[model samples]
Target: MTYSSGSLINQKKWILLFHFIIGAIIGVLLLHPLTTMVFWYEYKGLIEFPGNSPIEFLIQRLITEFKFELMPMSFVFALLGGIVGLLFGLYHIRLSGQKNLVRSLEHELAEELPLLIARGESEHLEFKSTYRWDVRQQRTNRALESIVIKTIAGFLNREGGTLLIGVEDNGNIIGIDSDFQTLKHKNRDGFERALMDTVKTSLGGNACALLHCRFHDIENKTICRVIVESAVEPVYYHEDSVARLMVRTGNSTRELDAREAHAYLSSRTTKSFSL
Candidate 1:
């Protein structure tokens, strides 16, 4: 799970060594012959038109003058070796990154963040530019709180997902600056508290237990990543006089009536109990 610094260093060394050896072999087989030919024909001018055919001339030239430019030719080969090593090293790094992406989703989210933001919207992930920042009105969007709560409740009633606030649907981080302006503390803490208050008020105090909110400053923008865990009990976005049950279907959130919700919950519990 954890790689020591010494092991990582050794891994790098092995990759470099392997690439260097391969490059040296290729340089010897490919570049060496071609370079020797060029030197013999152009610089030396030892092979006259009738003195010898091209093949015989080349073979004899290589046999005789192979040592003349040995140091310079070796330098060229070393340069080629370094280039090959660098290319392969870069490829190895890329493959390592891809493996990490496939192996640990948590690592991807935490470390490979550019790829994480670029992962886009799915059943397990959603993005919102802001909680209450209304671009048109130039103020906080009042309906934003309910919308977020509904999304959270939807996750709770379904397989659960991460809700990234301050990230647009198109995966752009506009930041929570507008929302922060409305808060008293005018920072991440205040914004988080306000969000939790909204969650507790809109859904229930108990729903807060199912959600964990964390703030990240990325690309000079404050992003709120809320991880909503699937609840044992189906969650409902309980507004005044209306407890609307919501669920996640693909990338969109859908609401269910009280009767429909009861039947869905009943069927789910029955299936779970049987399993």
Candidate 2:
């Protein structure tokens, strides 16, 4: 969950260098025309030349100006560009770190998914029969989407967990075909969009960044696995203007009262609530 200082420093140096190079190139490209435009605007009526047309006169001036000022102006512009690049790089360092951490977690989870499913639902794992289909009613149930969001919010509010859709509580691979039937696209891409939209709507846009969803083919069936990372701050599930705090308690998700939520957040700063 934490990155070393050395790696962070190295990443920062590379990002800064990359941005500086890009910015310098942009500056060099813009310098000549920009300076030419300024010069034309400042001295357009004031200067006279021996060309037949204004365009020809401007071209002659541009060539003359380039010969005299290009090198010195390029250096000034490149330095200014580099300083701007450094500021942008510094501003995005934390975001870059978070993205790297998320990618690392996703890679690890992809490799360990089968083992995690076989181990059954635990404090960090839970399985659902379908994303939005109700097997009992044999119909598309929109209410189940709320359940999915609740589980995701629970993981975000705790030490994080993985939720496997298209699997039964007892570890059966049922596939998400029934759920797909309810979607307009009726494919994996559509399902992912729907899932993420639900998370974004209920848990806020930032919560979507902490989640990584992947699909697997096992026993000729497709399964969706959602790996959630512990949030840096408290995440609340909003429903009908009401925001509720949910957390993973053993193998189930539970809602907390205001007092309990306050205590939980207070203690979370000093220690993790992972069991």
**Whole-model lDDT values for every prediction:** 0.79, 0.84
Give model 1's clash tally. 1
Give the TM-score (vs. native) of candidate 2: 0.61
The TM-score of candidate 1 is 0.59
1-275: candidate 2 lDDT, tens digit per residue = 66588986887889999988877776655654466567666777788544655567556655664365556876777777777777887778877768988778767866776787789999899999998999999999999999989999999988898899999998988999899999999999999999998998999999999998888777788899998999989999999999999999999999999899989988887675552
Instruction: List pairs with backbone clashes in candidate 2.
Output: none
Question: Highest TM-score among the candidates is held by which one?
Answer: 2
- Report the CA-based lDDT of candidate 2 relative to the real structure: 0.84
lDDT of 1 by residue, 103-166 (tens): 5765455565557789899998888878888876898777987788788888988888999998
Off by over 4 Å in 1: 1-108
How far residue 83's Cα lies from its native spot in candidate 1, in Å, is 60
Tell me how far the alpha carbon of residue 143 in candidate 2 is from the true structure, in angstroms, after superposition. 2.1
Model 2 ranges off by over 4 Å: 1-34, 50-54, 58-109, 232-234, 238-244, 257-275
